[model samples]
Target: MTMLDRRALLTKAAWAALAAPAALGGCASPAPLRHDPFRLGVASGDPLPDGMVLWTRLMGAPAAGADAAPLPGAEPIAVRWEVAEDAHFRRIAQRGVATALPELAHSVHVEVRGLAPGRWYHYRFLLGDAVSPPARTRTAPAPHELPGHLRLVHASCQRWEHGHYAAWRHVCAERPDLVVFLGDYVYEYPSPPDATGLARTHTLPLARTLADWRERYALHKSDPLLQAAHACAPWLVTWDDHEVQNDYAGTHGRGEPGDFLQLRAAAWQAFYEHMPLRAGTLAASGFGQLQLYRRQPWGRLAHLHVLDTRQWRDLQACRAPDGPARAVRPSACPELLQPGRTLLGTPQERWLREGLALDANSQPVRFSVLAQQTLFAPRHYPSGVQSTDSWDGYPAARTRLLQDIADIAPRNTVLLGGDIHQNYVCNVETQVAGRTRVVASEFCGTSVTSRSGTTQDKVDAIRRLNPHVLLARCEERGYCVSDVTPQRWTATLRAVRDPLDATSDAWDLARFVVEDGRPGPQPA
Candidate 1:
């Protein structure tokens, strides 16, 4: 049988299974009683070789000020979670109870463990007599196993008002081993004033309070395509600026002079409540200061180092009128020359340096993929308008990071980034000891729904400026899928026809492969 035939068969089977009856209780139902509804469905994320975090929320009837008020007569409720080897739950591997507290907005995150590696498992939550839909998750590949292949989809920037998430449907169809959400999962700003000709129109303004953020998340979660994608695989996620506010720097709000510390605290609390993060991993700083820089290994094929760039970085400088008018010009801005500016902050930088060192010694880890947000290589505006945001604003810090990569000299270093609503492949460059050194290759995924003006023009300009950049595509919107093997790591940039359309087709716009010991991406 052909590969296309197998894919068609699998798609048919998946849709058929979705229509099948869900697990039902054998016993008779009692008198109807008030029970918290499970509206958003169950999800699992942050998978490790031995464990993963499960998530769910208790949806109650809409109340006056449901967003803020404690649920009437609220009490701590026990949420029992179980992980089983099979979908039938006959052989349970892990089980535990977590408290659903009103303080946490009735969300539950249970981290389950004591499971075997490189295996698929099913998990669910039990609240009182009701059970949630089972969620499927897989553990990281075992060390030294050298699995034949690993597939993962990377996406970001899902602005609710921009358009529909039809791209998510294609991602779900792919059935990747994992999903890495780079960031901008939610935009905190109010709907743009000129939102005409957009995909999905916004119904409200910027998110200010916790309830506002919650409602925004609820709206996005209600999308069936996104939910289907989440249900398909365990995800690893980190936040960018929009998760709190646009252009927010450190503890400061965007241009607004107020108690930023308080705002940051609120944003952090709401973020933790809505995400599928392990309870213990939640931060107490109230400022969303959790350390998310961590590494995961997939046998000997790859090691992923996920980083948080927005939380600790310095404020992005405004573009200088007298300097570069185009954002894509590398020499247009002086802030890019700042001596001490940082993207990962001090602690995260230290952690990454240490982690890269560790990967250097580990034999099983071949490719060190920095799964992060923002374009690692310098990308300026084509019109000669310098961007105050992105790595270009902090050239010294980017230089430091590239230098570190050169020092560690992993077998192959690749930076996977998302944001900017465009896809790009660039060769990362920096200067060390007065010597120009190229460190790694970077692949930036385009937006899942967000819009950009120069999606097509930027691609052409990027290629013109950097020959090392193998490909660029700005006009299209879609996600990227990576297939990793012992010999090579291949990336396919998939683009969708139109996000506003109910049905959109996805096709591979470009393909590149990084062979073992190679430092750059080559067209496949």
Candidate 2:
């Protein structure tokens, strides 16, 4: 060949090499492993109609780490992964290899596509001699296709020291289409070494460094119950304060004395390392930022808008930036009423407002869901105080969001959230022409296993103060399973009999339904 022709051929070869480990139906060379490397178990998340991300981490001996972070200077390994139509792998739909790099803590995220829509599929990871667990995941329906039904279990705040993972055990039995994690996947605080009567101990130092954060995620992911829930379905995840530090507002962290930005970067990178998040999300968020907000369309039945309330919000008002989380009277903190204060920063706010206007069909969705992190209503407390860590602290922002829903999706919006350790079913109202109106329904599911410190009297006082609240209960710890149909949306507030019990079962504490074209939730 001529020199010019040779140079052109070399350029094409370089491009192909850059796109290495070709996708489905392509070729890959997988490797052999000495022992099983699935101790942390398998997980899948962020499913699309044609594809989703499948994840697993290569690990050393359990004694070394959970899917231990790779040793210094470890080389990247080619790990093979497969997507099948059946659990037994008889019908292999797609198979490919992904590199587990030391820089990413040896974790592999394989984006598998070209699968059928609205169908269940089984997936696993392979390292030649050893095989990982077979996990189940499903994709969403086609954009214009109206789904027959969709069931999702939303949960949050499971602290290791607070209780056992009985809530997740119950979730596995529910067999839902999707699992929505509204944040606090792992707590940053360590359990008191001298404390007794604890269900479990974090057994590590307070997570502040990169290694510390990795170790923290390892400890949490090792739980069989948590693993089972993950293996059950694809999850939609976002972070709350506990994932990094308590009550961290944007770059401000509990008013602590340290390089907070450096600490946040480590915690967030570790979060990316462990979560089955899209790799593009990390880069898109830019340095020192991690994007966690997106929209998930459930056919024409519902539009799920997952939001991030911690990463870009204004600093907490009134309290010392390093102060504890508490309910402060509005009069004491005038900044709470500032119009510019935000919980879901402006960019996210605009994105959410636009999505609620119309779906792909150019029609209002049957159910417009704000699958977010905190209570959205005006929740007044006993002494005219509201939580500084929740939406109650950003009144103007809350008003704007509520008004946006009123003007856009209006009667079909459902607000699903968590953060406060209580079960609440309430109405989100709007002021229309000097009259009070209920525009959207709200259900705040209590924690998966976190403890609630509020007393019955205090809860009673809160109920008396806010008449719009239909139900408020705080004794039990569990999650909410939302079943959506074209006619109505139903939420079952299920509570674990005992979060500390390994074999505990959950019972439906209460059920509420919002009929289509109606704006409020009623006992079902």
Candidate 3:
């Protein structure tokens, strides 16, 4: 061949090599990417009456970082998704193509629309010939149409190293209508030195960069039980501090401020990329600056106001740079009593207040639900001390919110939360002119696998100081399942006796109920 012909042939060979992976079903891994592109499984979230967000990530070849992001210059993978009326997908409802962009970690989030109200739909994604396992998702009930009953499981604090995710497997078996996650989805640090007798170990250390965060998320997602739970139902998720750094507040680190914006931005990006969130959550800069606080209704029966407390809160008062968690009395930490110290940032606070007002006055919903992170009810420790990281530290803000609840006086109000690693049932109360009155009922679920930070002695002391707290269990590792009706709401605590055992059985440890128009829970 002539010299020019030889050069052209060499160019063609290079292009063919680049296209080989795409030809062989887009398996980009060293052994050729497998047909199982659904290793992370499929998930749906942000349910509305008309639609929900369907998600899947196209894992081409296993990249250098163990599926943490993709190869630096890997070609964009073409992904197609479909929603069907049948599990077999014989009756196609919606289908579309979404390019899995490399910059966004090859993840595809399709906000599938035009579905029937309060109905289940099956969805799946296709990358060339490889198809993801089908997932089932449901839309919310129609407005003003009462759903006689709503079943949901709200959980948080699933530390990978502490134990097995048997609780998640159980939750999938229970098959609630929706799963609300409050926070601590993944711990930022790997298995720390102080984490004694852990059932498992994290492969990575503290997560700092985007790649690190992605790998951490992948590690958590690698659990089959967790993946089964995500596939089983639609999830409404909000993050707590561990999604970034532990105890991080709005633009503030746990202790003194430092140059953490870059870290925060990276963490936020990783969170959004992994979650089955809507398209609107994506920021122009690829960081998750999305306002996550909003309301969803189960027809006219319940209005759930999901909240984000960590991304928009003032720093904890009297927190030392490096030491144990700080709890202080009124005299020592005067900053704790400041009226301007807010857990929900100003904009979110206003939004929530206005939403509550609208629900109570104009909409007239039966139950107004506050779904958020941490304890909303006051927890007073012995000797007038309180945890600075929880609502106890932001008394003024909590009081303001309670006042809002009292002003409108919804027929029934319930608060759902997590993050304390213990189950608690309390009567949310507020004092006016030396007279204390219960305003709502709150149920905070325990961690899925992590150990409880509250000691039994401390829990007993706290119970004594806060009389409205009806039940507190600091030793269990499990989740809360709620059955809601127009007449009452019942929450049952399902605990895993041994979180280290993958095959261990979970039992209902306790159950509490709040009657309509009542502000406290009683043993049911």
Candidate 4:
């Protein structure tokens, strides 16, 4: 069939399934195929009020080489997907047939619409007679209505070789309404020989080409626990440095200097191909240009402003671009405070400001949620040093953003950040002249499996330096869950006892809350 005809068929099949649920019977009990075509598992993400994106890749094997290929030939593969009102898929809501083109790695991203809002859905994929595992997903509340409550998990930095994905298992157990993943979904580097013992290694070496990046993503997606989290809740994700390269800003890497645009193009393409992001975000040719920064609303309860920090940020300041730039004092790195330096870039910064304005004017947006990578709260090390990678590096830009936030002053502003691999609950204050006005609350979640950079003593030291910091933890690894109500928002930092142990159980490290009118976090 022609491409246009195939798309039409896919849409027709999906709507037909939705219109006549009874006609799409036996979805729960499809005859088994000769071979499993979904070894990488299935996922759903970016749920809207009426639709969500369902994802799956047809794979023949698990390895990176030819023996592990999913499809048999270069021809397009026909795949069928179904969404149901029940886990058993007895009440089908939507079903579609998609052509998994060989050029796009035999992956299918079906944007299924025409469903009820604030409801649960079970989805599965079919390849010929082969049936993929059924996964659960949910649609967001309708935009015009006000949601009474929302539960969401904020997670980031799941390095493959660090340890087991026990944190993901815990996240899936929570089964929150949604998941906001703030970057570092995959590391571009391979395991180093001198590194701490690895729980697993990358399927291939460092990802410099499209093939390498695809292999790495496939390897990570192969994890059953990770897949479970993706299947459980529709995720809104934005990548940090590791999604392409370590400490990369725009087209530049730390100090390994070259025109990295080509390599970046490959990484971008691979990321788009694997992610459950919508088709409109896909690039037409060359490197993919995805507008990763956008606002996702949970009715009027919250406006989750997901940011892309690494994509447009200016390079690190006060040192060589190739080497590790140690934390420096203000006097040593005055260039870091340059007015022109920006983390979100000018366009995105404007987009965010305008987006917040539009959201508040249109609805009763209770919370202006900043869900992005890296900390917005300033960290002051006891040695009179500050990180050059976080908001601290772009002091002027941070000031501008904070000042604007203070000026517009949303009812309840909270920043959800990750990338430091440490948990920090701080009060975001804007200082004008000599007066400090507490404008927002910041809850920075820890990593999933990555190691923390500081000890308890170090955490204490940093907290001492930055009095706005209410709580800090640096030794453990896990994610955070937040419960949002119209009256108050509470967050619980859940840390796994040991990331190396697959059976490790997580416990609540601490809990913080932001009251309806109060902008800063208070101990709960």
Candidate 5:
């Protein structure tokens, strides 16, 4: 029989078997093979009213070395995918075939389009007799339509060796319409010699080469709970430092070693292969250049401005030439106030300035959402010391962005972020025209499983100094869920009982709310 005949036959069989309601991670598991190529599972990201990108990678094994990718000179594999209007997949909304290339380690990115807006659909992939786990994805509400509500879960910093992914387990249960993941998705470090309190360990050394980065992503994605979160909803993802190296500013790394740009290219390639990023232009930077900063809308209610802080950022202030950033006293570091020092670079800053306002064919956006990595609010540490790693390092840059957001978007703005590994709900303020005012609400969320070095004493000191901070809680691992409506926006802080246990239960740490016109969160 021809290849098309085999695929046609398999399609019917796969759909027949996947018609069962329980499909996420519970499909075709009993079948045996040399190794599960769909080990990284499937994901959908950056949803629009029409569609989103569906991603999956074929891997022989996640271990470092030969099994990390397909054997030498392997031909691309033809994979079939289907999207159904119902959970049982009785009515097919969309179906197509995509080639999983060997050059990209047999990964597939299907940008399924032309779907109805503001609705959920079930999707699955079929390879030969093997059927991938069925997952769900939702399209954004149509631009002209004013949706009554929007629910999104913000998460980040799930370092592999630190703890369990129980936080993601709870995220799956939340049934959000979207998940905004802000960086540190994988740690670039090697497995520590001391297992000590580590709940997991990488089988490989530090990620440098393309193979190394690919294996690292596979290891992180190997966790079923993490896969479940991806399956639960479409995600809006942006990277932070650890995806390449710790505290890396643009192409430069800390006083460490090796060619940083090459390292960045490999890491970028692996990240693109693993993530459900929209397929488009390849930048001149080594691998395909991924344009991370863009605006996404949730109907007429909100406009999400997702920023890429690392790729285009100037090397953090007061660092040695070509070195990474460090916390320095403003008195010692004269370069800290350089007006040219930028976090989003100049081009991105211009794009953000333009993207913050109304788009070409979109309606008046009620909520202007800033989704980026790290805290947007000012942090004042005692003794005149400030971390050059956050927004505090670039006060002028921060003021520029904040002033534009305030001048254009005003009280309708909301900032969502991660990377601090702590929960901080603050009334973000900025100086514009000689007057400082709270113009946007900021919810800098905690890490998924990564541990925070911040202590309660430090939290207390920050609260004392920054009166705009409403809630500050560190030394815990969790995620945040926000519900946005025409009247108010509410956020529930979900924390896990034991991050070390796979089956650990998660509870609400706290809740905060912001009225439609108010630019700050209050205890609900």
Candidate 6:
């Protein structure tokens, strides 16, 4: 049977099973037997050449215990998994069975090894009679090998209530090697707030408990478009303000009292449960913190530096009517414009500086790509309006970051950002060695489903003020596809016709490419 057929059948079966229990007067439970398995879908993430992580959850009712817990006397069940070279399970390369217990919500995380590099493989989870759909994954390219070509798709800000995820369907069809989810994966605020913004078409009844978060994830995952995209390639994810709370800084919430430690802990736990991340166990401290910042090398073509900007950033000060002149006039908001104020914190900043130094001297690593969230270019509201939400609010910090990039002077450093619901391509210019130097290009992707009215026009106005910007597109909803090679790196902005319509099609709105020695983007 085809995948669509299988999915349809599963949907019908699930609905029937749910309704059967009520009609039978609770005499016959429609719950799957203990041995009848295949619960949650299969997923894989954090791909490495030597190995990758596999994940799955056990099946159970919403409340199998008196306390309404998922599983009461749930014993550890053994799950068997296999990775094969073919989809038919003919040549099995690696196999293993893991025990799932209640402590981890009956979820299994298997870090398998002994696999070939730069090759595709199929994997699945098995119990007694139930089997999950086959998932396809690939390993990263070797360290020094110069890959002829590399393709990647990036997207962000998927608000479930706003519209359908048709863009994800289009991206899945492209079959990218890696999928980069920038931020705002899930919103935490409840519905029906006092204030309504342009992006606030559909609001969720606030998320309070872990179950609320899980339900939200399930709703999104139920969308075939997103699931298909996840199944197509391994995903690298990061969270924005909405994932926890809007404008939350460090361990504090927006305007809540008491210690925010409890909320932070809960948010972290829920995040781990849904993502395909391997739980690393360390001595004394139990499991180590989930390290989000890291560098991935795609052969000799590019070095992708994934950054976490929200976790450690200082809160931005409100902008004045006349811009920085009036806002930082008395230095009352010095912390907001402080040179040492950081988005990646002190330690991460140091680490990134070191990584850039190494990549600048390395012969094999040609392009230095920074995958981050938010617009790096200086964006102002209009002639008189101003907001402290973007990088423009922190001029000193932005200058420092630009100076560092200029100092390194890598062959080609490109920044890919999301959040702000618009598209932009700008040149990062700064003063170096008593002379003006421009080094690197940046591409800011528009939202996948969020609303962005008049944003594109504002970006256009900013481009005119800042000549370094090559292009900007605001009035569109879509994702970006990038092609990386040794000689040049090209990025295409694909825009969807409309988000409200289910049958909307996608087309390339703009295209830009950067050569080996060039520092800025040019029309392809």
Best by lDDT: 2
The superposed Cα distance between candidate 5 and the true structure at residue 285, in angstroms, equals 4.6
Model 4 has an lDDT value of 0.81
Which regions of candidate 1 fall more than 4 Å away from where they truly are? 1-36, 62-73, 192-195, 255-258, 318-335, 380-384, 431-438
Per-residue error for 380 in candidate 1, Å, reads: 4.5
Q: How much lDDT does candidate 5 score?
A: 0.81
- What lDDT does each candidate get? 0.73, 0.82, 0.81, 0.81, 0.81, 0.69
Model 6 agreement with the true structure over 300-400: per-residue lDDT tens digits? 77788888776676665643322232223324555465566667778888888888887888773789888898888765444644445557666676787
| C-alpha TM-score for every candidate | 0.87, 0.92, 0.90, 0.91, 0.90, 0.84
Across 418-497, the per-residue lDDT of candidate 1 in tens digits comes to 87898888777667788766678888999998886664655687678766667777788899999888788899999898
**Model 2 pairs in collision:** 254-322, 255-321, 255-322
Q: How many angstroms is residue 30 displaced in model 2 relative to the true structure, after the best TM-score fit?
A: 8.7
Error of 1 at 174 (Å): 1.3
Task: List, in order, the clash count of every candidate structure.
Answer: 13, 3, 3, 5, 1, 3
Off by over 4 Å in 3: 1-35, 62-72, 193-196, 254-258, 283-288, 321-325, 432-434
TM-score of predicted structure 4: 0.91
Q: List the residue pairs that clash in candidate 5.
A: 283-289
* Weakest lDDT window of 10 consecutive positions for candidate 5: 13-22
lDDT of 5 by residue, 1-524 (tens): 24564344334323322222223331222234456567678999888898888888876644445334542345655677889999887999988776665656777777777899999999998776677899999999998888999988999999888889998888988899999999999999998999999997766888888989987887788789999999999998889999898888876784344577778878987887788876552343325256888888898788899999998777777777655577999988888888888999899999978877663224667788889999988888876688898898888899798778766764378899899999999998877677777888899999998889879998888889989889888977899999999888999999999888989998899999989888778899
Stretches of candidate 4 off by over 4 Å are: 1-33, 62-72, 194-196, 254-259, 284-288, 324-326
- Clash pairs, model 3 backbone: 27-33, 28-61, 29-61
| C-alpha root-mean-square deviation, each candidate | 9.9, 5.4, 7.6, 4.7, 6.9, 9.5
Cα-based lDDT at residue 147, candidate 3: 86
Candidate 5 ranges beyond 4 A from true positions: 1-35, 61-73, 254-258, 284-288, 321-324, 359-362, 432-435
The candidate that wins on TM-score is 2
